[model samples]
Target: MSASLQKQNIVSNFRQISSNKLILAVSCYLVLILNYPFLAKTFSAIVNSADYNVLFLISVPVLFICVFNIIQSMIAIGGFLKPVLIAMVVISSIIAYATLNYGTVFDFAMVQNVVESDSAEAFSYVNLTAIVFILMFGVVPALFIALAKIKKQSILTACINRSKVIGLCIIIVGLIGFSYFANYASVGRNNRDLVHYITPFKLFDASYKYATRHFFSPPREFLELDSTPFLKSSNGNPRVTVVLLGETARAQNFSLNGYEKDTNRFTKDLEIVSFLNISSCGTATAVSVPCMFSRLSKSEYDKQIANSQQNALDVAHLAGVDVLWIDNNNGSCKGVCNRISHIEISPDSQSKYCDGEYCLDEILLTELDKKLKNITHKDTLIVMHMMGSHGPTYYRRYPTNKRIFEPDCPRSDIQNCTNEELVNSYDNTISYTDFVVSQVISRLLQLDESTGSQSTMLYVSDHGESLGEKGVYLHGLPYAFAPAEQTHVPLLFWQDPENSSFSLDCLQNQAQLIASHDNFFDTLLGVLSVQSKLYQKHNDLIAKCKGDSRIAFKQGYGIQTNEETK
Candidate 1:
């Protein structure tokens, strides 16, 4: 073979490669054109992160599209490359939706393992995430690729029968995916049109030039607090109130609520009120806890935090509560400093005992014991926030050895775990929290008995937890959409029995009657002896149920109450 012969072979190979590249590029444009509805909404969110982790996780959807595209290509060879291009678009859309909404990067392999080992019931809800994946990454894209096949290729114009058939198949399937996307992206009645945005090409621009736009940035404002009279106790000394904030302690699981679980041994008689129909402001602690403490209702917590920004602690202090906060949470968000006294339980170097991954609420009790000594005056309010049933890593929230209710029948993962196991873990946390809170109540009672001073205890959780209802786990969903699990938390009050003012009958009635988290602001005002200037008289649980409040559930949606809306 001479030099010319070798050069000719190389030139032929280059032409073949170039032709394939052109075919693939053209296919991508076709899919994008066919599926414009889903792409537009998700684009900004996908590109915002401009991250490597996001791109890598996107492979799942990519593979889903690839499988569908290959099938279409095999059946209709005319536009074989179209399937691949469409797959790319769907994958990018996933990254766009998940990223835009501030979804965490999931460890798919670990999650899969958890689901596999656990009994089917154990991880039932967790598998919903998997379903979420298949839909976003699989079903919809495949539909497009399949439907794209509808447009028949011109047999007369085509030379290679195989290539032409594949190309046409690609078009038909791609169109199918688009039709589904149209209904899905629209957020309609049944489908609810959960749409995702972002195309592969846009994601590929890691330099983030596509994300760049000439937009105005909003100026951040400092949070403003309201002045009130919620500081002084019934006795009206210096006024110190300790609000123990529990996480995910649902009333259903408590023995106090008549559940078989002996979890609430601590709250046996001291007077507990079940805020029967009360709902959470949000699901995630990051969202709900801060939102609950915010002056805004669940309907407007996010909006209020976004624009106006006033927190419970901030207002309590301004009202002269001598607001002192000690948190056992993972971190701070509401910025409960500036105005009140702040003590971070997780970070305090002086904290001798608890360590690693959110403390088992007991630590707050111990810290409060030490801190209360300094509150020699009457009006000192202490807020203790606990890390309750935060999901996926429930075991991490509490010590494994302390897990009393085994075989736990413990499933390996979120999807695998049974409702019972999930509830058990949740109950165990509640049990531990009850023990700690009861200790505070008992001690306060003892202090009152010993010193001839008045003392009382109030306990409320930020929000409730979902076991596996409607294929959802944990909490922190948007308030309008959140389930009963996210909204209904436990509220109980324990007072010194010696005090005639601690009416047990009224307390029991309030527990069985209708109430809202909104009452937290006002009822505390009544208990603490200071009349809240901001208090609304309607929903105040103590005030409404003074004799026997019959209203069982606040019937409305998105935080609008009969009391407030009118």
Candidate 2:
């Protein structure tokens, strides 16, 4: 043969690959290339110089390779191999970018956030780094896979080969487990989140579970907690409770909660009282927001159950209080305000507080002013959802004037920025949030003075944020493994005493009590004085300090507990 012909023949032979070989090559590529973050984390978290530890480390990659190839053998068949692998490459690249840059885990909650986030919020994550990473790792590899020459196989031959691959993998896995069962169990028990760090597998598993629960399940029956809930207010002086629903504000960063930085300078001197120790239900808004509104406790909270029930807002609306939700955040109220009167402030809304991509939390105050001018009910509940400190665009959350912390991060690729810069930007958002909360208190006080009415301000963040702590930049780890920065949140309350019976001193005393999102529903009911069969007295933080028996009721007064119903 001629030299050029021989070279061409070699190239062609190298490019041609059978189905099983293709699956094996792709699985190895996934473990070694696309799953760099997972491997890096494993080495950092579990590797040591011990003999068994070294053996366990070596077996990790081998085990993953066998298992992944087995999965590919089942799914990536004759005509489907290229397309399926291309899709995996593309999606895994994106997931890998998030995991590498932000230490994100593609858990069920994170998947829900991605699936439900608005276009503006989603686009905030787009940047030069993401583009380069996806292009190099995702699109380029996908093109190679798509263009590869995959040899054909008959149905029977394919099935036999696939079964062989599966059997071999299972046997290999069993041998590894049997030989090192003690080490595996010890490591797994010690580092419970290690398995969740495995890329693509964990990501695919979570996506499938989310899809099945949200799309494949039968529609749950919507249950109303109370049909005849009544507002038991003092002499109807148009009681107004402005529930300032904050976003991404952690208690650890607040000066009111003992942080050295004066992040709460705007509201620190006001009549607001900060709850020193407050935990959120979940580490992400998609979970915590709906859970906060539901009557379910954190231990019992389920997304389907929360979505298919009458939340605190429903019972309050049914009790004759005019409820309005003004959302300035990028997302909706997660069905919390679906049954009530709600207004969504567009990010593109032509307002001074908006910059065409994300409106400042002050936009919520603009809507609040408009809602206050036209009060239609003697008792009202206004939920102002503030876009407070949502990141990696924390710099965009507040304006230039509100940049109280100097030398702040100004870019979206937050991992590249210094920790000091990131914290400064985040603290500025909190400072701006403090100003907004102070303004809400000011407006409520004005309403009380101008109309001889009673008004209160309740500010609670949906979930806390992670400011590059232990390499974790954003929220949404599994709740069992989430850090304090992602779970501990701030809760502030301010009430006008002239026209209302609730005392600020009592609230200040109660502020020291440890609480969680479980208190939110019953507390809202207590603040609005809404009498309902769904009211759980122990969960009502406000009623504990009301100093009245009517505000106090025994637990499980008007309804069956969730356990009983089950």
Candidate 3:
């Protein structure tokens, strides 16, 4: 044969091979692009660390790929594989980028954060870099798949192919299970966060769990409380108390709590008691806010029970204390303010401070005098929910003019910023919170002078934030594995000169005492002088603050105590 004829034959053979294996090639490429970063990280950790054996290093990837292929094959059965695969690719890309950027794990709690976030909060994460990266790696492949002409197979052939894939996956998983069960257990015990890095599967698993827990779950029944005690003048003046619920404000950043930074410049000089050791019930608003107002202790608390039971606000309202809840934060009061006179400062409301997205914490104090004047009751309990230091957009929480810390991180995606910049930005938010709290106290003091009313204010954060400490950021980790940054929150107490219910000297002395959100309900009840049957005197921080409370699950499972603060 001639050399030219032989070359032509070889070229034809190569073209035939490519045509025959086009779908398989595309699938393999899709899997590689989608899972490359995750696989690289997993393998790199296994290689660098002596903890994992060679077998695990090999089997983990193999099993993961097998399972992935099985999922793809199954999804392919209904001719919907392209769309599903595209969605998975995009989702996985976003998750992978986030994991890499923030050094976070995609667990149930993280999924819950995503689920609970509003559209604006969600959109803040959409950065140019992440979008470009996704477009290059994820969207391009998805576009290719979308544009490709997939060959329609017979129903029987498709079923057979799916069955074969499933059978292969089962066999591979079974082999892994039988051969390395002990190794798997040991690795899982040591490296639980590793499972969260398994690309598309982790995203799917988290979504399923969130949907099951949030959407498919049965509605919790509301628990009603008995009639509350009617408030009468204990002294010569009417009782007016303001409870300031702060968000994402950690104790570690407060100068009053011995932090080096001047974050609490406004409140540091005020006659306020700052608790040095204070833990939150949960690391998220959905849990902590509701739990803080519940009668049950953290250990005894049940989400169902807590949600159903009448909260501290309910008791105060029934007790004839004019209860009003003013919120600058977007989060709900978790039904704690349901029956009371509640008003949210709409982001859309005309205000010099508001930008139609989020108003400053100071906006909650907008109509302070008017709100106070309209209340016809002698004793009033006002709850002000401030949008204090909520992140990963710490800069947005405070006004630009309030940026005391220089060179603050202006971006919402905190991970992209340097640690120092992130802290500076976060500290500015805390400083602004200090300013807001001081303004609130000043308002109360002014009210006291004008109306001869005795006033007091209590400021406590819903949860603390993690500013890139130990590879964690923006809080909301499960309480068991969360660091102090996510759990240790700030608690401040202030009262007017005329108010003498609790001695400041004694309260200041008690500031060093350990406390948690479990004390909030009873303490506030005591402050309002509401003698309710549900109020536990032992849990009241002001009445008798002595016991070490355990931070437990809402399901009554004891986890740890204030000792974990160390």
Top candidate when judged by lDDT against the true structure? 2
Residue lDDT tens for model 1, 92-166: 445433333223111221122222232322333343555565476555766655444232346554435545545
**lDDT per residue, candidate 3, 1-566, as tens digits?**
99999999777665443211343444455456656656766676667665668988788767766667666766654556667767777777777677666655667767766766677777777778778888887788778667665555677876676676578778988999899788767666665666666776776788898788668989877767767465544755777898999999999999988889898888876677898899999888877888898887778865567767788888888888888888877746756677788987878879988888888888887756677776577888888988898887788988878999988899877877888899999999999999988988888888888888888899999999888886677877667777899899999877764434455555766788898998899889888888788878887777742122112211122223344657
The numbered model that scores best in TM-score is: 2
Ranking by TM-score: 2, 3, 1
Error of 3 at 359 (Å): 0.7
Q: Which stretches of candidate 3 lie over 4 Å from their true place?
A: 1-51, 104-106, 228-233, 299-304, 545-566
Clashes of 3: 1
Q: Which of candidates 1 and 2 is the stronger one according to lDDT?
A: 2
Greater lDDT among 2 and 3 belongs to 2
RMSD of each: 13.0, 7.0, 7.9
Clash number by candidate, in order: 63, 0, 1
Candidate lDDT values, in order = 0.54, 0.85, 0.76
